[model samples]
Structure formats: structure tokens, C-alpha cells
Target: MSKKLRVAVIGCGAIAQRRHIPEYEVNENVELVAFADPVNERAQLYADKHNAKAYMDYEELLKEVEVDAVSVCTPNALHAPVAIAAAKAGAHVLVEKPMAVSTEEGTAMIEAARQNGVQLMVAHNQRYMPPHVKAKEILDSGRLGKVITFRTAFGHPGPEGWSVDGRNSWFFRKPEASMGAMGDLGVHKSDLIRHLLSDEVSEVGAFVGTIHKEGTDVDDNATCILRMRSGAIGTLTASWTYYKGGDNSTIIWCENGVLKIDTDPVDNVIVELTNGNVERYQVGAMATNEQQTHSGVVDAFVTHILEGTTPLVSGEEGLKSLQVILGAFESQATGKNVKLD
Candidate 1:
């Protein structure tokens, strides 16, 4: 039998406990070795459950434990620093989405991984979902022809209900999260749209505001217009005011038909042709916070590490998505379109 890759998880927060740790536990190619968090008790609790070492400081854990890979599940502000340190420590890094708060930080992380000859992957799990995978297949087959426009949205009642800290979560704080709903949820749609259409966002015009939450400076709602490299125009929205629950869905308009994903309760992907034909596919419902599932991020990251292959959502790809969101923020400030280079 082949040896399993030893893995360490930094930040035993909601993401770590719910997705990274649980998924890594089931991966045959991986052995969860250590858990690290600022809170000693959280780390100890997960360590006890998983039969792994626990540390309150990630720096200390990295210095002592030699692991094949590490998942940086820290906050938005720490993503780049922790990922860079993990790469330098000779461990492949799997960082959560948005990559970093700034493009420079994201670039530094990529450079560090490159210098160390280690893989760096971002946890943009939306791209790995079954409906999204099938959507890409249909798009690539030219069945939808050229994508003319798209509208994608991701919104929930806010992370207060989901975070380990509840109402006092770092997600609502500016220093730790940078941007609220835009960074927390919008980035997912940005990454997903880029993957689904195999294109890049070239320009952005946006309206970002703190409309829903009290005592939070970060944006709770954002609506942006994206001009894709392929000349397709689209709108992306992220919000924390969906009190009725979350809504994550996308609709793509093409020359021949329209593709509706995760929109209808009866179907996962629906195709409405310009003619009289309609196609409906049941690819299973999209995963939600309350109904978490294997996001395929850990499995794919481990596969790349073991096979010496590049990850699908590489650090560079993640940086591009981050830049798009950042551009939206810039657009919001200038009240004009911001073009990406």
C-alpha cells in the first residue's frame, strides 16, 4: 500500500471543522496529523476527536510538525501569510477562497509556493459541485453556443448564524474579514463564473454597501456588472439579508438557449432552447451550510499533491478572482467602470 500524505489544518474555525477536517478524515490518501488554532480548546477538541496533535499557534505547529500538506483555513487577513509560511515550510497549501485581501499578498503566496516547488490551491469548491461540473461540460460541447450574458447570486441570512463565533464572528469585522458579503460570498460566484464560461472578467461597475447589518462596517450587499473577456456581460450579487434563507443560483443566456442552474427546485440544470425544445437535468441540489457535503476540494488537493500535478484552482487562478472583486470595490468607490489588466 502507498503511504498516505500527512496533513495539518490551521484555524479550527467553522470552515475547518465543517469541511476541511471532515473531508480530510475520509480521504484515503491523507492522514490528518495536527490541528492548530488561536484557541487552545478548539484545537484540542478536534485533535482529540481525530487522534492528532493540537497547538494554539500555527507557527509553532509548522516548526515542529513535518507534514506533506497543510490547509490554511484562517481568516481573510491571514490567508496569504499562513499559506506563504506553509509553502516555505515544505508543505503544499490549500487556502480558502478570495486567496487574500490584496493582489500583492496573493502574488507573494504564489511566488513563495513557486520558489519552494510546492503546490498552492484555493478552496473554491463551487467549481467542483456536480451541477457546475455538468454545466461546464454542456458549455464546452457548444450546445449553449456563445454565452451572451449571465446572472449569478449568492446570499444567506449572514455568517452570524453559521460562524463558530455567531453574532460576534470575525466575518462581520473589517480588520479580519476585509469585506463582508462581497468577500464571504461574492468571490465564490466570481470564481464559479470564470470556470463555467472559461473566461475572465475584464471590467467591473458596482454598488457595495452596508445595508443589512448593524454595527458592521463591511459591506452586507453588493451588486456588480461584469464585462467578460469574451464580450459577455453579466451581473453578480452577494448579500447577507436573505432572511428567508440562502439562494445560490446562476442563469446563463446563450445564442441558442438559456441555462438555468440551481434555480428551479425540481431540477438542477435546465435548458430552454430558442426553438421549442427544453432539457432538464437532475444533477442533485447544491450544497448548503446546513446540509454540508464533500466539496471535493480536499480530495482534489490531495490528488494533485500525490500525483505531482497542478491543482485546478491554482493560486494564480484564485488571484484573478480576487482581483475582480477588488476591482468591483474600486468601481464602487469611483462610481464608474474599472478595467482589469
Candidate 2:
């Protein structure tokens, strides 16, 4: 058998600890060889658990560990710099969602990967969900006919109650990350909308505010109206103070019928026709838990590296999604629709 690919995970935070590291542990094709975190204890904890080297500084980890690739699971602001460093170090990169806080930073990551001749994949795991895969298939099959309009929504009960440390919740900090619900949850909806519609967003009109996050520098809920290049209309909502279980759902209105991409863990997708008929699609295989989803991404990453294939979610795709997030911010700031070229 070919040797397992050596992989390093940067940022041993909740995401890296709960998702990326365990995934690498379970995947037989990949080896978790090193771990890094600004916090020495956290890095040490991860390394001890996974039997890998640990470093407080990511640069030191990069230099000391002979990693085949690295997973950039750091803060929103650090993604581009870490990814660029990994690419320059001759390692492939798999960056977590939203790519970066700005389009310029995202572009820099992409350019660095291209210049370094390394594969750069973004962890837009929702795209790999069975419901999303089925939706993409239906869209491509022309069953939805010409896509006319789409509505997508995702929400949670806010991360303040979920993070390990309530005081250091990065989701509530704008400088460390960006907007609240928009970056954390909104980007996923935007990504799924783009994925299902097979189109680029042309313009954005948005409303973002810190209505529920009592003392945060970021928004807790936001909505964006999107105009697709293909002349399709769509609406996306991301929130943190939802009354019920977390929701990730999308409804696409087409010429023939309406297709629903409900990424809710229970009911994935549903389709309805003009004749009042309905059909449900339950797509499962990839695990729904964070760690399992990370496994799916890791498997894809190792496979692409070993087999000489392209990533399922390329850096360019991540950049597009980031643009939508940024555009929404701009729209919210100007109180006017932002246009995309």
C-alpha cells in the first residue's frame, strides 16, 4: 500500500479540535503528523491525543514537520496568510469556509497556491452534503427548468452559549472574524445558493445588525437579496437567535416546479410540482457531525493529492462565496444594493 499522506492541522481551536484532527485520525489514507495553536496547552493536548508533534507557533510547526498538506482552521483574518505560507512551503492547503474576510485576501491565497503549484481546496462541506449533491444533480438535469428564484436560510441559537470559552468568543468579534451570522452561517447559504443555481451573484441588497448579540461588535442576524448573473433572484438569511433547532434550508422556484434543499439533519430535500405533487429526497452518506464532515473533506483532500485530481471545492469557488459575504456587508453599510461585475 502507498504510504499515508502526512497532514498538519493549524489552529487547534474548537473547529480544529472538534473536526479536523479527529477526521485525520480516522482516515486511513492520511496521517495527522503535526498540530499548532497560539495556545501551547491546546496544541499540546491535540498533539498528545493524536500522537503528533505540537508547536505554539504555526511557522515553527511548518518548518519542523514534514507535512504533505495543512488544514487552515484558524481565525477569519489569519486564513490567507496561513494558507499562503502552507502553499509556499510546498504543501497543499484545505482552508475552512469563507476563505477570508475580504476578496483581496482570498485572491492572495488563491494566487499563492497557483504560483506555488499546490492544490488549494476550501472546506465548503455543505456542498458535499447528500441533499446539496442531489440538488445539484436536479439542477444540472434541468428538472428545475430555468431557475427563476431561490430562498435560502440557516440559523442557530448563537455561539455564545456553545463556545468553550464564552469570554473569548471569536464569532462576536468583528476584527478577529467579520460579521456574525453572515460570516458564520450566511456564507454557507450563499455558497449553497451559488452551488445549486450554477450561477454567480450579480448584486446584493442586505440588512445586517446586532439585534440579539447583546454586547458584540458583529451582527447576530442578516438577510441579503441576490441577483444572479443568469437573471435569477434569490434571498438568503443567516441568524443566530432562532427559536428552534438550527436550520439550513433552501427553496428554489423554477419554471416547472419548486425544489427544496433543506439541509436540516432530518429532512434534506423536498420537491413540489405545479400539479400539486411532491417528492422527498433523503441524501445521506457523509456524516453530519463536524468531525465526520471534516473526514469527508480530508478524504477528498488526500485523494486529490495522491490521485492527481482537482479539489471538489476549489479556492476560487471559496473566493466567490466570500465576495457574496463581503458584498452583503457593503450593502448593509451603504443601505444600497451592491453590484458585482
Candidate 3:
């Protein structure tokens, strides 16, 4: 058998514990080698569990350990610097969603990975969801005809309800998280819409506000209007006020029919044709904070590293999604439509 690739996880935060580390543990192509976090105890805990080395400083870990790849699960603000440093250290990077806090940061990280000849993938797991996969296949089959418009939403009570740090998590801090719902939740919908339509967002108009949640300088609710390159217009919303439960549903209106994804409790993907025909598919259940099954991110990242191929959610694709959210923020600030170049 081929030797397993050495993998290191930076940041023993909620995402690292729940998704990256767990997924990497199951991937046969990888061997978890090291764990790093600012909190030494957190890093040591995961390291002890996995029988790996632990370090409080990622820079020290990168310099000392010879890792083949690293997962950047730190807060949004640290995404760019840590990913760039990891690439420079000759390690492929699987960064969490939103890519970075800004377009400049995202671009810099991509350039660093390109310069280092290391693969860089974003953990945009929404595209890997079964319902989303089925939706993409149905749309590509021309059964939906030309997509006219769509609406997508990703909302939950708050990250505090899920994060290991609870109410005092970095997710609520503006400096560490940059933005709240838009950065944390909205970016997922933006990336998913782009993946489903295979088009870029050309323009955006948005309203972002702090309707709920206290002790934070970030927006808790955000709504945006997107104009796709294919001339399809849509609405995107992200909120932290969905106190009942998380709702990650999408509706697409096409010329021939409408496709609803993750909208029903029974059917994960539903397609209705103009000729009075309806198809319902029971794709796997949607992932939630309480019940997150294996997201294919770590496995795909390992596959690309082992095979020396590009990842599905490459850094460039991730940057596009990040730019859309940044454009929405600009739109919110200017109170006008912002165009993407």
C-alpha cells in the first residue's frame, strides 16, 4: 500500500473537532500527525486522543513537523495568514469556508499556494451534500430548462449554541470573525448557488443589520439580491434569529419547472414539471450542528493530495464565493447595487 500522507490540523476549535479532525481520522489516505491551537490544552487534548504531537503555535508546528497537508480551522481573520504560511511550508491546505475576511486576503492565499505548487481547497461542504448533488444533476440534465430565479437561506439560532466556547466564542467577536451571519452562514448559500447554476454573481444589493444577538458588533441578519452572470436573479438570506431550528432550504424556478432542495422533511430534493409531473427524491438528511455526518471535505482533500490533482472546491472557486459576500457588504454600506468584476 502507498504510504499515508501526513496531515496536521491547525486550530482545535469547534470546526476542527467536529468536522476536519473527525473526517481526517476516517480517511485511509491520511495519517493525522499534529494538532495546533493557541490554547495548549485544547491542542494537547486532541493530540492525546489521536496519538499526535501538539503545539500552541502553528508557526512552531509548521517549522518543526514535516506535514504533507494541513486543515485551517481557525477563525475567519486567521484564514489567510495561516493558509499562506502552510502553503509556504510545503503543505497543501484545506481551509474552512468564506476563504478569508476580504478579497485581498483570499487572493494572497491563492497566490501563495500557486507559488508553492500546493493544492488549496475550501471546505465548502454544502456542494458535497446529497440533495445538492442531485439538484445539480437534475439542473444539468435540462429537466429544469433555463433557471430563471432562485432563493436560498441558511439560518440557525447562533454559533454559541454549537461552538465549544459557547456564548463567548470567537464567532461573536468582530475582529476574529469579521462578520456574523453573512460571513458564517451566507457564504455557504452563495457558494452553493454558484455551484448549482455554474455561473458567477455579477451584482449584489443587500441589507445587513444586527436584529438579534447582543454583545456583538456584527450583523445577525443579512438579505441580498444577486444578479448572476447567466441573467438569473435571486435572493439570499442568512440569519441568526431562527430560534426554532436551523433551516437550510433552497427553491429554484426554471422555465420548465421548479426544484426545491432540502425544503421538506420527507423529500430532500423535489422537482415539479410544468406538465403536471412531480418527482421527489429522498436524498440523505441535511447536516446540522447537532447531527453532522461525514462531510466529504477531508476525504476529497486527501484524494487530491494523494493523486496530485486539483480539488473540486479550489481556492479560485472559493475566492469567487468570498467576493460575492464582500460585494454584498459593500452594497449594504453604499445602499446601492455593487458590481463584481
How far residue 239's Cα lies from its native spot in candidate 2, in Å, is 0.8
lDDT of 3 by residue, 204-238 (tens): 99999898798898899999999999999999999
What is the per-residue lDDT of model 1 for residues 37-144, given as tens digits with 9 covering 90 to 100? 998999999889879999998989999999989999888999988999999999999999879999899999999999999999999999999889988999999977
Q: Is candidate 2 or candidate 3 better by TM-score?
A: 3
RMSD of 1: 0.9
Q: Is candidate 1 or candidate 2 better by lDDT?
A: 1
* Backbone clashes, each candidate: 0, 0, 0
Q: List the residue pairs that clash in candidate 3.
A: none
- Residue 135 shift from truth in candidate 1, angstroms: 0.8
TM-scores for all candidates: the values are 0.99, 0.94, 0.99
lDDT over C-alpha atoms for residue 280 of model 1 = 94
Candidate 2 regions with alpha-carbon error over 4 angstroms = 263-267, 285-295
Q: Candidates 1 and 2: which is better by TM-score?
A: 1
Give the lDDT of residue 250 in candidate 2: 80
What shift in Å separates residue 103 of candidate 3 from its native position after superposition?
Answer: 0.9
> How much is 292 displaced in model 3, in angstroms?
0.9
Worst 10 residues of 3 by lDDT: 21-30
For each candidate in the order shown, give its overall lDDT on alpha carbons: 0.93, 0.83, 0.93
List ranges where model 3 is wrong by over 4 Å. none
